[model samples]
Target: MFYFSVSMREVAFIKQNKEKWLNFEKTIYNNQFKNPDELSSLYIHLMNDLAYAQTYYPKSKTISYLNQLASAAFQRIYRTKREKTNRFISFWKTEVPLIVYQFRRYVLYSFLIFGLFVTIGAVSAAYDDSFVRLILGDGYVNTTLENIEKGDPVAIYKSGSNWGSFIGITLNNLYVGLLSFIYGVFGGFGTGYILMHNGIMVGAFQYFFHDQGVLWESVRGIWIHGAMEIFAIVIEGAAGLLLGASILFPKTYSRMASFKMGLKNGIKILISTFPFTFAAGFLEGFVTRYSNIMPNWLSVGIILITLSMISFYYLIYPHIVHRKLKTHVSTL
Candidate 1:
């Protein structure tokens, strides 16, 4: 039997493939690949070489050089491969829902907190006449009171041109949603505060209309947009709380790593709410203005449809997608 020392084998391995390795490195650095197949072929060959090097000459500098070359080739091949799905469509269909499902507890918590604050606002307003004014601000309360007397309680929606109102309302809602997500850095208390403030205002505002004997009318108008608008806000609050929780409790990861993960996932959830927010603004600006003149059935239908659409997307659809994916993964 022939005997070959490890050092001789390592030197012979380097000598045999040194030119090919150098050429591959040049091809990668210069972006000189002819096509995806060529790049993939190079990557495969390099990986095989890497496996051989790792097994035999694990302590050699040749291993480091080949490893670097393999990494670069792999990155290039990965970047060049065509995506199998439309990224934008996939983001909405798979990515957002999965993230929402993963952190679903936060969503439930957000809804409960907001609901509790809303109840407090309604109860306080019921007991104290000044509570509405105190929460809603004197100017808004006075204007709404006058609008109530005029028998067009939601006339505020009719003030601006459709485009102007749509743009302004959309911008404001986006701002609020963003603030809710950003405030999560304060360990989620900031997000809770935003939800509380919005919930209280909504509760007080609704109670005021109820007290004035136009509860149904206000519901018809406000909820035309409020259904989607308020739901989106609650989801945004959840994203914020998720962010805070990531920092407060970095389970297996370091705090910074956990924060990055949380922020990425939280941002996805927040971005998912944008379409609903815009839809809400459109309804508020264009559709809501006609609440008084539009038939009750039509207004009610709009409210139900908008509410159902948003509710299905955020709440029900996530579970469906998650279950389907989980089942498919298990089968595989």
Candidate 2:
């Protein structure tokens, strides 16, 4: 029988192909390839060499080297294919949810801050009837008063065309969300200010309805959309706080690196709010106008569903995913 040591064959093969393999690596690393097609051609040749090594010397270092080279080339050749895949799907399905889970403390803080400010507004309005006018402005209060007399305190929502209202409101809401997120650059003060401002407005607005003996009615109507709208704002506020926390406390990472990570995660969290914002705007523009006419059960149902969806996706689902990921890593 013929006797040929694997090492002897491997040395001969490497001696023959070393230059070509090195050139291929250099071309890839230097970005000298003209296009993906040329890169793919090199990758095919490398794979053939890798296959030969695997067959002849499965447990040899040559096999390992060839396998690694082939893998790298394969990744390079199909890099664009991965990029061209459905980014939107990956973002929503994994990225955003992971971020939410990772930074849940910020979300809780935002909620507490917002709730405190709301209490301040409500207590102030309760003590002084003029507080509503002070917070909401005279014209708005007067118009709302007139609407109350007309038995439609929320009539203002019905004035605009549905589609126009949808577009305008959605844009405005998105802008506010952007503001809440970008303001994180100011060490989160700007974000906190925005949350407090919105919270006060909400508390005062609800109290205004209460003064007119329509607090329950107002809840049924406004909360149908407000549930999503306000919840998203809270989430956005959390993103801002996350940015601030990164800058304030970088921990092990360099400040710049931490800031960059924070910004990236914050943006992911911010993007996740868009669907909720759009849904809220649609509800306010179309469904809110009919609040006076819609059955109480339907309004309540919408509010519950919207709130439940937000809570489940942002709060519950994130924890579940994080736990599963931790388990997976532990097993690995």
Candidate 3:
């Protein structure tokens, strides 16, 4: 009867905490806790229960169940701690690249659209003498023409102090990027309009300098920052296109759900281009102003390096990261 009473005690202990154990299991599996501190507190409580079970119910199946529960909680706590420490690094290295890879088609579409408009702008400028002025505004055209006559077609960039130029240009570029992303709400037509506006302006601006017999000079100076600046704009355009596509093609998800997903991912892509945008503005303000004095090789090198860096991040790095993840999952 003493042995029977001990067994009954163990059963009573299991019965008492059965619901609590189930709750802990659910929380662990679903990651439903509000914070790590809460999870840790629950883990500590579970450990105490586990110790009690081990001491008094050493021969019971209750011991096995409590041991498994404690083990799972410990693993979860360790994983949570590790992830918290590495979250920032993981966001850039894995999260953004994966999103870019998933939406690569949008990136291609953006490039095609922007490139087509640029071609149209160039062709229009070639045929019509007033087309450049019409697209770039008469004020800008006159100022540029005056600068060209003074043997510095890009002299407008040299107007402001380096720090002032950097801040102003950076803010303007960020505004353009934000507009490119936010305009996707109009089924992407608004984004297309923005892209067309910018693409045409760029083509016409370059053509104007080319028409003045300073094409190479303009190329040397303009491309110093334009490489990264234009590329970032194109990527932001891709994010906008992705946003529009999500609404137009919801597939298995409800339209609202799809929109939410698209907005989240599109914003992530847009955020990724910010560093490149800032670099472009910095180059435009501080470096491009000195393009006239810098050696042709130096200008070309800067352009190449900036283009390569941004290009690799958006275009090439995505594929590499995707492949690495695929291989890791396969091995697992």
- Per-residue alpha-carbon lDDT of candidate 2 for residues 32-97, written as tens digits (9 for 90 to 100): 787776776677678779889878888876665565455445334433334444867757765577
lDDT of each: 0.85, 0.82, 0.82
TM-score of each: 0.75, 0.74, 0.75
lDDT of 3 at 8: 70
Weakest 10 consecutive residues, lDDT, candidate 2?
A: 74-83
Candidate 3 residues lying further than 4 Å off, grouped into runs, are: 1-85
In model 2, where do residues sit more than 4 Å from their true spots?
1-85
Ten contiguous residues with the weakest lDDT in model 1:
323-332
lDDT of candidate 1 over 118-224, digit per residue (tens): 99889999999999999988988888889988999998779979999999999999999999999999999999999999999888889998999999999999899
Best of the two (1, 3) by lDDT: 1
Model 1: how far is 150 from its true place, Å? 1.9
- Tens-digit per-residue lDDT, 19-129, candidate 3: 787788778757888776677777777777888988887776566556655544544554454455476677787678877887888899999989988888888999999
